[model samples]
Target: MTNSTRSGKRDRLAGAAVRVLHEQGVEKTTLADIARAADVPVGNVYYYFKTKDQLIEAAIAAHGHHLESVIATLERLPTPQERLKALVHSWVEQRDLAAKYGCPTGTLASELDKRDDGLDRAIAKVMGELLGWMERQFAAMGREDARELAVALMAAYQGISLLTNTFRDPALMEMEGHRLERWIDSLA
Candidate 1:
């Protein structure tokens, strides 16, 4: 196969890895599950990623790229407050999925954090990138304690996500999204 075709398959595998990992949790997700999700044969998964850790690494990279793209879009907003509100709104749009399966990154990171294999560190990098972006936004809003504001923003998001998932209530995300928007505006 051509290199592009090979990459297409690899990308598909990685995307499926993220979805499967999100839906089923990393520990319970098998190569077969990813293959089934990707609509490819099990051997095809090994051709791209030899082990579960490799797949997890690919998922982390995929999440990182996706997060960067999102931040890029958010950066286009007129102000830091608007950007931060847009971020919360976008996540709130995924309320149904969060209700069913939880915030994809947060859930995966929480689960992987308990392991000794260092995959946790890989996922943590994605979270760090997000934290850095939020910190910059807070700084743009003229907050001297940008890091603390970033942590607070993330805490509210993560806390609401947990409650939304735990209660299986999408409305909770809506309410918190509004509250977060107001909080961000107040800070601005």
Candidate 2:
């Protein structure tokens, strides 16, 4: 196949993997499910990812890149406060998904933390990247306890995600999102 086609196929597979992995727990998602979601044959999955673990690695990388892009866009806003609020807003917009499946990174990390294959470290690093980004934004706002503030903010988010999913209520996420935005403003 041409390089462009090959790359497109792999990207599709990775994208599908991320979505499937988020919607279904990692324990339940199979290469066949990803192949179906990507509209590729199950046999062809081996061409790009030799094993399920390899595909999950690619998916996690894709998820990280997507997070970075979102953070970059938030950075374009004028102030640190606005950037942080925008980040919350972006997440709040996914309330329905959050209610259905919980925070993508949080759920994935929670599940993978049980494995002994070291994927727990990979997911932890992804979570750390998020916390680190939040910490930087808080630091820019002149917070002395930037890391603490970052952890607090993320704790609120993950907590609400679990509550929302457990209750099957998007309204819980929306309410908590507003509260988190207000809390960020208070910090400012």
Best by lDDT: 1
Where does the lowest 10-residue lDDT sum fall in candidate 1? Answer: 37-46
lDDT of 1 by residue, 1-188 (tens): 99998999889989999999999999999999999998889988889999999989999899998999999999888998888899999999999999999999999999999888998888888999999999999999899999999999999999999999999999999999999998998897
- TM-scores for the candidates: 0.98, 0.98
lDDT, each prediction: 0.92, 0.92
Clashes of each: 0, 0
Cα shift from native, residue 171, model 2 (Å)? 0.4
What overall lDDT, based on C-alpha atoms, would model 1 receive against the true structure? 0.92
